[model samples]
Target: MKYFIITGTSRGLGEAMAFKLISPEHQLICISRTKNNDLIAASSHLDYYEFDLQNVNQIEALMEQVFQKINLTNADGVYLINNAAIISPFSRIEQANSQDLMDNLHVNLLAPIVLTSSFIRLTQHLPLEKRILNISSASAKQLLPGMSAYSAAKAGLDAFSSCVGLEQGVESAAVKIVSVYPGMVDTSLQEQARNTSNEALTTPDIFKMVKDRGMLASPAATADKLISFLLGHSFHQGAVVEDLFL
Candidate 1:
């Protein structure tokens, strides 16, 4: 059976992906800040963890517990999808609060790095396929005025993925890694941006324009494409891609 360890499964694209991946042939271990009753009622082949990712100190223990749910004797492949993120503190760099900045960095950047490190370390000896998919954003490549924290965190994720990809090349059982921009999905992150006051942002119109034109992709559709690319043969290891599934 295939195994999937996914984050932010409480809602949005993560939830959509979880719904699509449910089957007798796959086992899902989902992590989120709160439990989704719908998800619980939908599947018996899944394990749910209501743990916050921002509490980076406890991720190692969490992963230890997560791995215990898998039986390697019957395992076909193990995958880690780091899809949790926060798009808050959407203010000019200097105007943003220090606490918010730290929280943003911790949630969006440090947490994934630590999780990936733990995932690789824990699964390195296993004799099975392993892959890591990091959900990135276009903000990583652009210089948006109010998105410094989010952009930097995503950019760091991309660079970190590249570095990890390089390291994996020398290993006999290298774990594949891909950092992808899942495109402009109609998620809470977009809502937060659209709701932000214009005075706090330099490019506020961009969000407004996207919404006005209905340019955002639905969470279900985006998740469908993302999961297809992730599980398909076209996935290139260590690639930092933008709009690849589109």
Candidate 2:
């Protein structure tokens, strides 16, 4: 059996991935701020945690609780999908809110780093295949106005992924880590971006244009492609991928 610990499983791509991964051969442990009732009713193989990622200080304890549900001795693989993030307070650096910046960095960067560290530390001796997939965005590399905090966090995450990948390379039981940009998906983040004031986002029309042109990918489709690449032979550890390997 393979165990998957996924964050932000309430909705969007995270939710889609959770649904796609449900099976008798795989057990899913999902963490999110709120629980999805439909998801819970759909599978007995799922273990849902209605806890917030912003509380980074408690993630280790939370993971310990999550690990209790798994039988590590018989597991063939363990996966952590750091898919939780918030893109808000869209403003220029000069105008950004301090609390917003802190919250954004906390959820998007710090939480993932801490979680990855915990996963690596806890499973270091395990001989099973271990992999970490960090859900990233194009904003990390693009120079968009009013996205300083979000962009910085994502860029930092990418750098962190590279460093950890290097650290794992020499280990006897190495863990595969990859940060991927999942392309433009029609999620709540996009809605927030589209609804932001012109003062906050200088390129507000970009979001509008994407929707108008019907270019935004669906969450289910994007999740399908991402999961395929994640579980497929083409996956490369330590790669800072710009595309979804599409």
Best by lDDT: 1
Which segments of model 2 are wrong by more than 4 Å?
Answer: 170-172, 198-200
lDDT of 1 by residue, 45-107 (tens): 999999988899999999999998889899989999999999988888888899899989988
Q: Give TM per candidate.
A: 0.96, 0.97
What RMSD, rounded to one decimal, does every model reach?
Answer: 1.3, 1.2
Model 1 lDDT at residue 101: 93
lDDT of each: 0.90, 0.89
Clash pairs (backbone) in predicted model 2: none
87 in model 1: Cα distance from truth in Å?
0.5
lDDT, residue 198, model 2? 54
Model 2, residue 97: distance off in Å is: 1.5
What lDDT tens digits, residue by residue, belong to model 2 across residues 142-191? Answer: 96887888999999999999899998894548998999999999989888
Clashes of each: 0, 0
